[model samples]
Every structure is written in C-alpha cells, then in structure tokens.
Target: MHSLETVILLLVFVLGLALLAQRIHLVFPILLTVGGLVIGFIPGLPRVVLDPSVVLLVFLPPILYSAAWYTNWSDFRQYVEPVIVLALGLVLVTSLGVALLAHSIIPGFTVSMGLLLGAIISPSDAVAATTIMKTQSVPRKIVTILEGESLVNDASALVLLQLALTSVTTGAFSLENALLEFVILSVGGIGTGLALGFISFCIHKHAKLEPALETVLTFVTAYLAYLVAEHLHLSGVLSVVTAGLFIGHKQSRVHSPIVRMQAVAVWDFVIVLLNGLIFILIGLQLPHVVNAIRGQSADYLCVYGIGISLAVVVIRFVYIFMADTVSNQIRSLIHRAPIFPSRRYTTLLAYISMRGIVSLAAVLSIPEKLPNGSPFPGRNLILFITFCVILFTLVVQGILLPLVIRALAFGQPSTDYLSRHEVQKQLSQRALRQVQRLIDQDKLTGIAVQAVIAQHQMRVRELANAETAPLLDQHQLNQKLMLTSIQAQRDELINLRDRQQIDIELFHEMENELDRQEIQWHPVSG
Candidate 1:
C-alpha cells in the first residue's frame, strides 16, 4: 500500500477501536495511545518524523485555543488565585526541583541540561489531564481548577523551556532577562489575539455566508493567530488561546444559530483529531528517542530514566499537595468557601502529572550542536527519560486511575433524571415569564397567547411529574412537538430572508428573538 493509504487505514482502525471502547464505557484517548504504540512498533511502517517545533506550531495552538474557548470564563475568573498558583507557581517550583534532582542524581549532567529536562516535563499535558478527568464525576470547583491550570500552565512551561534552551546554547543565563521575556511574550500574545479576534468577529458579523464558511473562518483564525505571532517572535500559543477564548465567548451573541453550531462542530472535530494524532505521534517517537542515545549503555540509561521518572512523579505530588494546602487556606480566609480536600482526589491529581506530547516535543527541540561545537550533552538521554516518563504516566497511571477513583469513592452518584427535570423546570418557568410579558404588552392575544401559556404550563407539570415518575412518554412527546415547530419556524424565516421579503433589520430582530426562545426551550446545561 502507498504510505498515505497505509496511514489512512491505520486511522480508520484507531477510530473503530475508539468507537468500540466508547460502547464499553472506556476512555478513548488512552486506547488510542496504546493502539498507536502497538502500530508504531510494526516494521516497514513509514517512520513518522515529528519535529518538536512542528508539533507546537501545528498542534498546540488549536488544542489550547479550543480548550480555552470552551472553558467557563466565570468559573475561571472566580478561581483566578488558585489557578495562578497552580499554573505559574507550581510549574516553576516543579521545574526547579526536578532540575536539582536531575543534576544531583544523573552522572555527568550539567545544571543547564537538568533544567532543560525540568522545563520540558514540568507542565502536565492539559489534553491528557482533562480527558482523564472528564470520565469521573468530581466537584465543580476541583474540575474548574484542573481545567484552568491546564490552560495556563502550557504558556508558562513553554516560556520557561525556551529560556532554558537559550541558556544552554549560549552558555549563560539571566533570571531578569527570562522574566522580561515572559512578560513581553504573554502581553504581546494577548494583544495579538484580541486584535485578530476582533477583526475576525467584525468580518463574521458583516459577511453574508454559509455556516460552513464561518466555521472555516474559525479554524483559519486559530492558526493564523499562531503563525502571525510566531513570525513576530511572540508567544503563538498564548495568542491562539486568547483569540479562541474571545471568539468562543462572544460568538453566541454575534453569530446566527446555524453559524454558531457549525463552528462548534468543526472545532470539536478538529480538536479530537489533533489530540488523537498528538498522542499517536508521541508513541511513534519512542524508537527514535531510544536511538538518540548513542553512547550510553542501555542498562545505565534505563536506571537513569527510572530515577528521573521517580523524581518527576514525587516532586509533582509534593508540589500539588503543598499548593493545594496553601490554596485552601487562602480560599477560606478570602471567600469563606469550605476547604474539603479529599486525600484520594489529591493522590489522583498527583498521579495525573503525566508528561506526554509536550515533554517529548521539547526534548526533541534541543539543538543538535552547542556553540562550542560539541553535540548537546545527553540530548538522547533526555529524550529517553522523557519517553520513560510518558510510559509511566500513560500506562501505569492510566491503568490505575480508575481503581484509585473507585477506591476513593470519588465518583458522584449519577444525577441524570433529577438534573434533567430541574433544567426542564427552569426552562418552563422562563418560557412562562416570557409569555406573560408578551401578553401584558398586548403583543400576544387570544388563541396564540392561550396556546403558548397552556403549553408552558404543561411543560412545567411534566417536569414536576418527572420527580415522582419517569414521565418519559410525556417528555418525549413534548420534545418532539416543540422541536418540530422550532424547525418549521426556522425554515420559514430562512425562506423569507432569502427572498428579501422582510427588511434586514426586522429579519435580524426576529431571528434574535427566535434564538432566545429556542435557547429557553432547550437548556443545554443538564
């Protein structure tokens, strides 16, 4: 088979495996990674050469952007303090501690090399952490912290990694310069993102186009922001993240429903593909990473890898535990929120410090030759250790994560039916209020007002009935009728707008009202 064909076939197999795993209630990311490792070891398969820079340039931006966009901005704002501590402070502490341990334990390793390794593995892959955590039912606050930490820490870790790499190459380092660069990169990236996002939003607002075209624009915007920022030597990752968050938060207010839904679907697919490809690429690099170690004895490298892995794991645990303690105290004093840190949750959080694609990418990013002309010291060794850490994280930690959750009793009881009913009740109340206001204003009259009011009341009663009985039949019937009518109105509006039968301003006004009505009728939270 042609190499491209072979790659396509492999992707199909992986997708199939993912779907099968879904049926069995298993997480797909872990399965995809394992499948990739197995496929990577097969002989005659084309070697997937993944440059570290390419990984960041191509994959990191979209993934980070999508993550930040979907993140609950309100929750993020509320927990800014803890998020900052975990994202910035914990990363710095872990990097320094790992550097110290690596220098002390590994023979012939320089401080620069140790620090480089430290920076490479310091920030946990938000992709991996979030994917694993999604399967278990955790507290909202805890989940928010994890999500917020993952989103911010990448920028910190990447900045630190670049600084360390530059220091290694130049044979000198300055803390002040590093700090200045961090500030410049962060601020510049955010500025670029906002500028680009606003421009895109304006274009979207004015353009008369299909939903698919708008969706395409969103995809292009993420990469464009990254490329533009990097061309100017700014933080591309941060820029892309900022743009995504801005677009995601505001698109609902600006775009049509069709455009918004289309954009969401497109971004969702892109994120899934990128994440799957990243993990698989990590697995494919295993052999090359092992081959990078030319002079070191296999046994010695294994021993070194083992030691560094232990240090990475232990240091992360200590860092998280300490940060959590400090965060709890601050939260209590400032907000008076209850401090309930489950030991089991903390332990799981500690084990979740798995280094994957990002670590491997950074390790591979080491310059082949230093300024003095000697090849970079222990580059291969660093790669080897990074792979070991990935394995330890994905295999050991992934396998045991569920067991830990079960043992800790961390999964909340399923909230399915009650939650759904509560959401329906809320929606019914909102609809009733809307109808009453329309009647009071003399906008709705006679049969039309009575029909809407009766329907709203029936919905309220059905939701109430759900608390006592399943009410599945009644709920299903109401949902069907409501959705059919919504579709009919949407179709009628589209026809009228296309024919220019309604003035543009009036069309938009009615469409916005319809959108609000649709949202009230079908709340997504539950």
Candidate 2:
C-alpha cells in the first residue's frame, strides 16, 4: 500500500478499536496492540517498519509535552521526593535487576548488554497508566507521583541505555565519565527546556498571537525543546518534559482563554491518535522481529520473554515495598505520620509498571550492526523480548488494574471538586461586594447592575450550600435556563446574518460574544 493509504487505514483501524474499547470498557492501548497484532499477521498485508529515529524525533516531544502539560504542578511539587526516587533510583535498580536476570538467562550475554536491554524497558509509560487511572477512583497522590515519574524516568533510562550501548559496542567503559555525562545531560536538558519555555511564555504574553497561532507555537515549542536538547547531545526527553511543565504552568496566566481551550482540545485528540497508532505499530513489529530472529527456537524466545517480563514485575514490586518501608521509618523518626499507604496502595503502584512507546522506541533504536561490521548481538532477540514485555504489561496488567482498583475501593472523595466549589463561592462573594461598592459610588447604574448583583448573590448562595441537594438541583436548572436563553440569542443572530440584516463582521462579533457567554455557562463543554 502507498504511504497515504496506509495512514488512512491505520486511522480507521484506530477509530474502530477505540469505539470497541469504549463499548467493552477495555483500555484502548491494550486493544490497539492486539488489533495491530491481528492485522500484522493477516496474509498479504504490507509489512510496516517504523523508523526508530523518526519515532523518537516526531512522537516523543508532543507526547511528553502533553503529559507534562496536564500534570498538576502543586501535586507534583508535593510528591517531588518520591517522584525522584522512582524516576532515578527505582529506574536504576530495575535496570540492574533486569540486567542480572538477562545475563544469567542468556548465553554469552554480558552485563552491559543486559543493562542495555534493561534500560530500554525500565520506564513505565504514563499514557496507558494515566488513561486507565482516570477512569477509576484512584488516589490523587498516586496519580501525581506516577505522572512526575513518567516525565523524568525516560531521561534516566535513555542515559543508561546510551552508556550501556557505548560499553557494549566500543568494548570500553568508565563509571566516572558515565556518571558525569548523565548529570550533564539531565541538567542541560532541564536548562534547555526552561529557556525555551520562558521564550514561549514571552511570545504568548507579549506577542498576543491569535488562538490558532498560539496553538501552533505549542507544537513548535515541544519539538524545539526535544530537537535542541538532542542537538546538544543532552536528554531530549527531559527537555520536552521540562518545557511542557513550565509552559503548562504559565499558559493560564499568559495565553488567552480561547488559546488555552483550543490547545487543550487539539492536544487531547493528537495524543490519543498518537497513542493508538503507537500501540498498533508495536503489534505490527512482531512479524519483523520473529523473522529477524529466525534461528532462535520459538520455545526458547518464549521462555526468555516470559522470564524477563516476570523479572521486570518482580523487581518493581520488591523495590516499591522496600522503599516504602525505608521512607516510613525515616518519617517516624522525624515524628511525621507514616504517610499511611496501606498494602493496597503499594500494590497498585507496583502494578502500574506498564511499558509503552518510549521503551519500544529505545529498543528499536539499537544499532543494526557494530562498528566492526558484525551484526549487533541479540538485537532481534532483544526487540522480541521488549515487544513481549510491552504486550504483557499492557494486556495483562491494564486489564486487571481496573478490577484491582474496584476491589480495593479507594474511597477518598476527590478534594478537587470541593476546592473548586469553595473557590467559586469566594469569587462570587467578592464580585457581589465589588458590585455593591460600584453602586454606592455611582460608578455603575441601571437595571443591569441589579441583575448582575442578583446573579452573583445567587451564585454565592448556591456554592455555599452546594452540599444541599435542593440547592444543587436549582443551580443545575438555572444553568439550563441560562443556556437556553443564550441559544435563543444565537439563533436570532444567525437568522439576522442569513437575511443580510447584519454585515458579516457584525455577525462574527456577535457570534464570538455568544461563544464567550456559552463558555461561562458550560465551560467544560465549550
């Protein structure tokens, strides 16, 4: 099939699977992966080989940026310590454990080679985990830590993979140099991200670009962060993530509401499409991986795959429990409460070790051949094993995570809803006071002023008694009536435009005003 045709087909496939996934209450990533496998094995279909470099360059930035963009900065700051432990410390430990397992299991496999493989699959994917978690009633802290770890962990794993690759391919290694390089890459990437994020913020604040242009710049900023960091031989993943974090935090203050809304919608769709395509592409790699390692027996590869997959899960479980214990002990010594994560929370955290795009991209990016013109040892096997790990985690754990959460019944009512309600109430009271002062000063006048005061008073009362069922229902009905009135105005405006009673410019201005009002009434839908 031609390139365009192939892309169209993939999109259709993704859309179909997404719908099916929704109907069946399954995680889309798992379904997409399985769908890709089914279609990949279909006879006479085109064999697709993804360019590893393209995957890193094109997909990584936007995906990382989007994840960072949505992450709650306050929550991330609160959980910074554990996020660091998981992103840096746990990643290294998991890599080492997988390395040991691979070295022991595979004949002629060196520790460095094993480390290379381990690093490729060490970082758990946020896309899959967050998507699943959003559908369930998960604790807010778990969500933040997982998101923060995902943002940082890829950089650490990539650094380790690079070092291991260097050691394996060149037959030379230096621990001190490697450590120094990791620091430089991480720090430099973060610096690059901050610099770019500031630049983007200034552009949005000062330039006052229109919504479309501002949205476009977000994509450009993401790519620029990654590309610049990579060009500097730093951690591109870290750069993208940092840029995302800074931009996400500042955009609300700098960018207009239209820009924020448009960007959110665009980013959400693009991320979903990218994620779906990625998983499907992962499944499609099976045929090529198998063909590449034709010499290895099926049974042999299966054993390696199963063993390595099991090792990855076991290592995470062991590390998380141990870390929890140590952290709780220190907190107790300092007279702080033990943070009170029961075994259930810890188990959920451990089970959230699903690997996705980054791991597959890293493994695939491994050199096809060494400098000496020999085939890269176990390249195919490593790819196969990585594929197995991705498949197993996404399919098995993804399916079970929801069930587990349901069973565990994390009963923490979301504090976010209550906080928002309180804030709304406070804002309404302030508005009412301001309106009263304006009337007293004669700065505002007429029936409109009284109407505005009445609206504000009603809002304050409703929010204050938000827990009362009758008042809540009244608020909902008020919103519906307001929306209906807005719709009627919109219809009249459209009718005037159609009958040429109003010029196009006036029509558009009126339409935009209506849109602004609609957003106030139904912010999420708008």
Q: Which candidate ranks first by lDDT, i.e. highest?
A: 2
Q: Write the per-residue lDDT of candidate 1 for residues 350-412, one digit (tens) a residue.
A: 777666666655676676667788987778778767777777776677767766666777667
Clashing pairs in 2: none
Candidate 1 deviation (Cα RMSD): 7.9
lDDT of 2 by residue, 258-353 (tens): 676688789889988887777677667678779888667889899999999998998889998999899899998998876545877788888888
Candidate 1, superposed: residue stretches over 4 Å from native: 1-3, 23-25, 126-137, 327-345, 364-377, 410-418, 439-449, 465-526
| Whole-model alpha-carbon lDDT for candidate 1 | 0.69
- Global Cα RMSD, each model: 7.9, 8.8
24: Cα error in model 1, Å: 5.5
Worst 10 residues of 1 by lDDT: 468-477
